[model samples]
Target: MDPLHDLTSHDLRVRHAMEYEYRRGTNPSVAAININQAYPKAVSERTCQRWWKRWQEEGVDVEDKERPGFQSKVDNEELRDLIEMNPRFSSEEIGEILGVDSSTIRRHLKAIGKKYVSSVWVPHDLTPQQKAKRVNTCKDLLSLQDSDPFIRWMVTGDEKLIYYVNDSKKSEWRSPGQRPVGRPRPDFRQQKVMLSVWWDKSGIIHWELLEVGATISAEVYCQQLTRLREKLKENRKSLVNHWGVNFHQDNAPSHTAKMTQNLLKDFGWKIIPHPPYSPDIAPSDYYLFRSMQHFLDGKKFKNREEVEVAVKEFFGLKEKNWFAEGIEKLPNKWREVIELDGDYIIN
Candidate 1:
């Protein structure tokens, strides 16, 4: 064998080099020795001999042989129909139904432009009749606004429960691989307060903490409406005289009770026609309460008094324009409800 040998490994380039050496009159042992000298990681003499024989017989190719396996059963039409029937199905669940691997199902899902996502939360599942009612009512309100602009006269109110502690359970910035921080467990028996508030475009008309242990029944609601009327007369006397109170509230049991309806007539306040199951369009639920929830995101209160103070402060901190904007959005929301053909608008 020649002392000056080159390495020829089990690779296309190495095999080609060996072939070149053999064709140039170098012996096989000399070619192998030369290749091993040059490349410490070169294949053994036996591997070179085998590849060299193959090159002579079938030519040189480095790629592996073709692989074989079972074909997929996830057809485009079937997968699309499955997703249309149930958008909430998981990859694993779909795999089980279709007799395929979850990974394969995921691939097909992406190919068909399908994705798993959280469903939006709507306040109510309205019936077709209720939806038609919403459309008709919103159309009526929009028509009225064109001539009267009664949106400015609207005084909407609602009640919400405020707990002693507000924990958003939001994530925080942390080092990689560390466990996420947990929120402190609030006392199961912690104190809570019910806030009943009324407001118009200009600002808050009246808000009160319901007497301890007193839920708002029809009688209590009527009394609150009377107080709201007095507050309106004081703060917005001229507007009230002009519009005579376009009161807007949800169809709660107490609110829709015959006694509550009769009391509004006695107080001479005009009740706005609010369609049932339409809290998404109400200014109190969609606008004011949402803003308040953001303001009270992580606050903690020891008692109802502190919660009241915070609530009052939140109302006071807002400019008159803030209230006006909230009220003005009502017309747009009404239009949206109509545009959606009576479906609940997700904020």
Candidate 2:
């Protein structure tokens, strides 16, 4: 029988198997010519040579190697539909739905110009009216700042919990491939003190570490205001004399209670209107406390007195400009909140 007639009679799989056997004994050129003799659509001699080289390098398998590319399980349209169903679904969750790994989901999502980030934490899910109130308040404050040294006249205060264990101990030296030594987990039951403070653009006017087991109530808050009044007389007499006072505080129940409002009225101080759930606009929260928290990082306190001493030292070390800057940040933040349409001003 003619070799070309026999080649065309059988399939390529049988011929390829014969080629491998031929390559084991004869050269690739001989195998190529032999494969062509029997096959109708003959593979080139170069193709046979390439297959022989691959077999030598990567086992005796004749199948083609897997090529490199994105190789995603879910296509663009499928992913778009999945995201449209729920934009907030995590990559892991989406991966489960699409039968792919989270990393694959992330890669595909990125290819389609999608990203994942943390949701900003805010005190409340603001209503449309509440958002409008924030915008109006910010615009009013900005207007006030343009005409007056509003920051200097402002008396802002807030309470913060200073923990005994503030150290993050986030790093430790370890030999390569060895587990890093970690600090002890923070004790939730550790002793902590609440530091209630009042300040202006000048600096800290007054601060008190609340007594153990004593939380601030309307009565306690009222008494603190009375103390704050005395402190203003002593430390900020000039400011008080010139601008009276513009008290700025969150709408805590204790702060907005009838007694608190009456106390401000009686003292002849003006209560600056603060929007509800708007701590991002508060100087104490967005600026002062942020700085204090940074300073307190990696610090461990033994007792309340140590914490107090540290707190006082931290306050004393700050320059007058630092306090001024903290208050100065407020107007910008207010404007940002307005620009964001009452959303929290996240850094």
lDDT of each: 0.70, 0.70
TM-scores, each model vs. reference: 0.61, 0.61
Per residue, candidate 2 scores C-alpha lDDT tens digits across 168-275 of 534343211123354543443346677899998888999999875466788889999999999999998887787789898987677888888899899999888898
Q: Which has the greatest lDDT?
A: 2
- Model 1 — TM-score against the truth? 0.61
Model 2 spans with C-alpha error above 4 angstroms: 1-124, 169-182
Clash count in backbone of candidate 1: 6
Worst 10 residues of 2 by lDDT: 115-124
**Residue range 1-347, candidate 1, lDDT tens digits:** 10101111234456566667666766666777887676554546666666556667877554323223423668879877766444434564566566665557766776765543222122224678888999999999999989888777788898865767777746343211123465664442235566899988788889998754456788988888888878887899787776577888977778899999898888777788888667678788778887888888799988778888899899989999999998888889999999999986754
The local lDDT score (0 to 100) that residue 324 gets in candidate 2 is: 90
Residue runs of model 1 more than 4 Å from their true location after superposition:
1-124, 171-181, 187-190
